[model samples]
Target: MLSPRFQGLKIIVSDSAMRELFKLGKDMHDVLEVLESGYDAPRKRKAGTIERWLDKGKKTVNAIIALDYNETMQEECWVLVHFGKFARNKK
Candidate 1:
């Protein structure tokens, strides 16, 4: 069962994203949690990308998504392009 926050939101996982998710041992629940509660930020105009951050219990995960707004259907769909742990620069 999906959480209420994910209701009416269409999510598509890309091949690359699926591979990354498997590599990171993340499932759809993790992705949905990020989309529901993570910090959302706008990205470049290409494909209407958006960046989101999810705070797991031990670490944070970052997700890149491409969004499409369907005016005819009056729906918003998003594709997960990439997702992985949030890497911090160690300077």
Candidate 2:
């Protein structure tokens, strides 16, 4: 089941998406890294951006986005990424 906040995301769990995630060296650490980076960036990180980081594959990115939207996991802090750089936004 998915949360109401994530219901808006039309994310589907597909085999190919899962396979691609495995192919991209995905793990709890990597997912957490992406999540942390995604959440701790100023530029409203989109699903596409995270996908790009995940080996530049659309499926990989979508998977991460889905996990994030579903709140299966969350970032420890929030920040912003601007012009390809990260900046801490919280004290």
lDDT of each: 0.74, 0.35
lDDT of 1 by residue, 1-86 (tens): 64222446677778999999999898888887787789865444454677788766666788777776656558787778888896
lDDT of 1 at 4: 28
Q: Which stretches of candidate 2 lie over 4 Å from their true place?
A: 1-14, 39-64, 67-91
Write down the worst ten-residue block by lDDT for model 1. 1-10
Per-residue lDDT tens digits for candidate 2, residues 1-91, read 5322222333333465445556655543444445444333333545443332322332223223433332444432221121121232344
Colliding pairs, model 2: 40-79, 41-79, 41-80, 41-81, 42-80, 42-81, 51-61
Task: Show pairs that collide, candidate 1.
Answer: none
CA lDDT, candidate 1, residue 78: 76
Q: How many backbone clashes does candidate 1 have?
A: 0
Reference-based TM-score of each model = 0.67, 0.29
Global fold similarity of model 2 (TM-score): 0.29
Candidate 1 off by > 4 Å:
1-7, 41-47, 69-76, 89-91
Top candidate on TM-score is: 1
| Candidate number with greatest lDDT | 1
